[model samples]
Target: MHKRGQSFLGEVRDQIRSKEAKDFVSAELNHHLKAAKNKWIEKGMDETEAEEKAVVQMGSPITLGQKLNKLHRPKVDWLTVMLLVTTLGLGFLPILFMDADYYLQYNMDASSFSVQKVVFSLLGAVLAFCVMLVNYRRLESFGWLFYSIGVLILVLLQNSFDMINGVSILVIGPFTINSLSVMPFFLLAWASFFNHKKLKLWHLSLLFVCSFWLFVNTVNLPAIYIYTFMVFGLFLCSRFSRKIKWMITGGIMGSLLLLGFIVWPSLEMYQLVRLLAFVNPEQYAEGEGYMMLLLQDHISKAGWFGNALNSGTIPNVHTDFVFVGFTYYFGWLAACALFIVLALFIVRIIMIARNIHEPFGKLLLNGAVALYTVQLVSNVGMTFGLVPITTISLPFISYGLIPIVLNAFIVGVVLSVYRRKDLTSMRTFQPQQ
Candidate 1:
């Protein structure tokens, strides 16, 4: 080739070598060649001659060495997965082996109390695992739609009058759906996840008002409070400390004002009893304080080793006061171990949230952590008389199917965050494992 032709080949080769050169080559190459080729054609070179001219004009293919570089992929944290699965197994197996009859005397044969509850709990985990395999970012666009559907289902369930043995499956089914409770969690989290929660005051105001509306309509303070804490946590994660302070002040004042004016319950009845019982156990002792008395007395009998499963005189040891079972049958060390696992669960969620660079994935993980922490603190606190009982459970430790299933699904969302890649930002990453 001529010296100029050699220079042309070198330029083409160098452009192909550097991947970054792709944009420059893509934009300019065809135009540069077509013009050069037309000139050759107009001068009476044939089509094949013009094509040769165009190829030579762009430079030679031999110099394209950059194509040898391979694209990089993100690293997976398999250790995290292994540790999580092991913990879940430990947490779940106790409930499976303990036997349902050990839980409640009255409803021992009921479907809610039957062995099938375990299936629902595991199913929730299964569903969550499948969902985690989906890329999480893709949900932002459809968040509102998913949220609305969750709300609509509760609304429809509320209108039912049918009952099994006087217990309505609609309002408090084998599950519970206080429109006021679950919907706020679904919607507020969705709203907060998008846009780094760049919500205007009106947007926040709207969520509160909608929550209050649903609360009054349904009368579910425990669920509403759970929802409130979750939303507030999401907002805190999204905003600055100063804004959080202002929001909290406004929220407290607004909550008290609403409590005063509305006929709605502020301290949900069960929680109110736990509060009053803790304060004046004598005045409320016979009627409302009975369970607390039983729980405290049973825990007193528990020593270093603790009595065996059926040895304790505790009633309802498997359900509401299960932590007492941990303390009583398994001893204080087991109770301490319960908290340790709970701590591990929350810390794992925080680590996942911190590692994620994207806003939505972080919010998803934050929501899961906040939700679990709220329930964990209240349930165990009430058991020990530190906080009022609000009918909350110990997350995965509690065997309630409906709520546990929902929590399991949330875990799947956390798994989605870990599966994402660095070079390719997929919307949701669903992992098979």
Candidate 2:
């Protein structure tokens, strides 16, 4: 009966709630039923009998629909959710105690900055979730737009803005946005789409030139290094040839060395002193190396449990040197726990990146993971005098608005990739008969 064919598809549609699942099942069933009907027709059956036979041979529509529904369901990554909760719990705990009136001994002023920090943190969290809901493929269309905006910001900051203590901050009315923190996100997004059939020299040159100008203008060495590493990771993960990979690697290395050469001479005496202090902190303990010396002193005093937040008089202890202050306050065991959680998060991201189905998504995630890894190492290393203090914020634990929001957005994009790891896409469509 012709009605049998209609009944079969309708039964499948009734079993599956999502249109995507229903369409997919209907297409597969139609394809199979057409073949079965042809087989029956060639075997001497009439069209109506053939249609009825095809419906029977295609198996139970309810069972097939149930299986397809299970396959197409959106999967939530519970592990990532739990890890993020642990990270946020540990990260916000310090600010809670530091800013609370009951804990302040010297009548600390309760400024609006603290309230804004919490507000931005919540906003960042919401932004990340919103980004996850968006289709990542759609973001590819805006790659150049994002890149141009970043480059434009750097250009404006270099030429039009007045310098604040020798560093440029883009001031828009009431808010001063840090160009260093924002530029890398755009650059990394640009890098994600660089994979091509043939690796063009001009494309590579464009990337180098933009990165070079950003580095020259901002003079934020740590951010530049992270951005550079991200570019490297992006290229390495791309589908380029081995020769091209080597060439890109060499070009990046050469460019970094040349940039350092050009930027080094322009550095102030104190900046040069800070670079030297990384080699030997004690030799310059009273001068530019004082931060490193003080950081070491604070870390040394913090036993396994910490000095209960009695971090010595290190300037900007709550910002640049917060990790040391944290270890000194919470103890080394808590620091180790923090380290374990961070390590697991990075590892989880890497695992997800590797498993991602799309090349662009994979490359994008590689850049993000590389940026986070570099920032983590740089910040933690600075806390113990292992690396030069470059004023880089610790990824999730830092006390800053831009870093928190940007990091949340990055994590959200990664989660978007993870959530849709199985299906390359889902599109609304009508089922064909």
Candidate 3:
């Protein structure tokens, strides 16, 4: 090897041995270099030739380190986090002024955001653990069964159940599934993984058509529409029967047109107003455009660093407008950080989808990526007026405990995807059988 190559290799080796680097990152770095070297040697090159080719192919190791610097895997550093939480609690002085109502509604005393965060975090951890313990692939086996259960829960919620103690149990106690929260997984169960690939067009058509009809009673209409789009996206991913995709797409489109006709006369004036507002937001500024307009004002003033002290309050701050304080407090730096983190998560899912050994795994990950990406964009963009006002919350950052915990379940699923030892990892890229 050239002296330059030797020095670069030594630096990388030192990095691998240091505590600053993760095993996965270090391992992948080495794997890339080894791959480059193997390619040259496999071509019957001499040592110098192989070394030159390997070095060129692998890029400069220093540059590789710089590229990876920004992407260090997030660690759950509890000590730092706890200190941050303590500061946020004390800083509630400023925080309260911005979104005082949100804090007030939650009874923002000693245990407002902090205490609730603890509850939600623990809840998220438990749910994630349960999902982690189960065989994710096995989830495919009972796909339709799970789909039916999801529909049934949504039905019971809108039709029969009541939140007696402000809590409605999804499946009694042990497996309390929330209809609104579990929609992502339930939707994935049907559109992505049901054993309908070999089935005929009419079969797929019938199943989805009926699912939409039955689900509408409690499907959270916006979520249904979003999932419908995700279904089409996953259909494109599946190299399944072509007729199945066409039939299902045609059925959904046709059904939507028919439903629009049937429901138009009976639809509430408010719904029409909202739709009209979506068409022309500026025209309805005082009425339907209030949320969008106010949200923009708050975020704009948030500037680089968020509003000084407590002047940064935005309406619906905690739930819908949670980005308000974040912008003012952490400034654009924080806002940019959130967007980057979310993008990484979506990209990670897509990358994981590529690694799976089976079509079903690909299907699930694609559906999940769609769900995560769409909801994220809708939330942030709607807040900033890039889209119409949609009441979706940011997946991880929003204060809705149920969705927060649900998000943790998704994290676990992705981690489950990540840690699968049986899959074709970098060391052994056997073409899927």
Candidate 4:
């Protein structure tokens, strides 16, 4: 309560450049002053004298603030940055050398596609950088807003969206937005919701049920899978009681089972055929399994150092099957190397998430990791015929403007969390009585 303590804290705050770090620094400094003052008071010193001595014991405010400033300064994970850049470069190779004949069949220009990819990549990089500079903590309070926006986007896509290759897309002028694009909004929203200290079990259940219904209505299987996995990941990292956590886990499992039993019969002929093909690709080779068989054949022919094979016949070679095409041209060794880089990129982010002390930041990173991991595993698994084929794109490597940009935004968020990991205190600073 002394003027001396207040003046010292003000001086300390002046040295801290980051506005986000200022509150934490001030709180911690005040806590220390209060504790020291209480100690002097216990020793029978006068109140004013104790406060003055406590302030003096903290040493020069300018020096202490400068030290704290250095510790709390924004950091960049250059190693992760390098790994991401390496993966992006490797991903561009297949697109750069895509077969022109394949584009002709779809009435598209190969040259323009490559050029567009280049533009998108640049835009994605810029977006990542821009997002990295933002304070992620500011998003914690906007959970409901983000959730509403995400649900609205999904509803629009579900009701009146243009159909492209059986996938719903909203075409706005020159840009086409897919259902998957709503993921980041939902991811951040769920992260905020899970980290909420006062969120009730009933309210959480309602939110999950509503989101699940919207996702199901969209019929984007990849988005559904990613969303489900993300929610589970967030729940596991949430600060809920063990009983509540288990209840939620059981509820999700039961819902999925019930949906499977009810939705299976209602699935369209093509959807049923796709599922059947996944179970027995050889039996449905002439229909939905044709692509699966072709992928296997190409992968088998792709040697450690390439097989000199033309990958023109592969469908969506530049997008979904880009990995197979890359393997055919650059060899399995190169593909594995690329995979290692991707894995390292993911691991680096996980490591950063582990070090973060802030609940919301950690949740955000975990949610992103969950979504990316599922997309990576599912996409690669399908390419290897280990999982059912879906429209999931390889993160960062997929040839789409929206996917790349959205992925970059997620990466930027991870960077933002890493930037301030040191600045966050483990517990809230409180002044000693």
- Candidate 4: clashing pairs of residues: none
Off by over 4 Å in 4: 34-48, 258-271, 308-311, 426-433
Q: TM-score of predicted model 1? A: 0.70
- Per-residue lDDT, model 2, residue 319, is 58
What would the TM-scores of all predictions be? 0.70, 0.81, 0.66, 0.91
Worst lDDT run of 10 residues, candidate 2, spans: 424-433
Position 237, candidate 2: lDDT? 74
User: After aligning candidate 4 to the native by TM-score, how far in Å is the CA of 128 from where it should be?
Assistant: 1.6
lDDT of 1 by residue, 1-433 (tens): 3344345445554545333333334334445555666778899997667767666544435433242112212234564455445544545544533554554555465455445655755676577667666666667777656656655654564455344422113544355543423532474345443344466656765856664555444444566677777776776665446776687769878988987667346668876676678876667768777767777787788776666655555555555667777777777887787688767778878877777767777777787787778877887887777776555666666665655665666666667667663323322322111
Q: Write the per-residue lDDT of candidate 2 for residues 58-146, one digit (tens) a residue.
A: 67788866766777655667787677666665667556335344225434445664676567667777877887776676577677677
Q: Please, what is the whole-model Cα lDDT of each candidate in the order they appear?
A: 0.60, 0.70, 0.61, 0.82
List candidate 1 stretches off by more than 4 Å: 1-84, 91-104, 109-114, 160-199, 239-241, 244-275, 421-433
The global Cα lDDT (0 to 1) of model 4 is 0.82
Model 4 clash count equals 0
Model 4 lDDT tens row, 185-239:
9988999998887888678879988888887877677878888888888888888
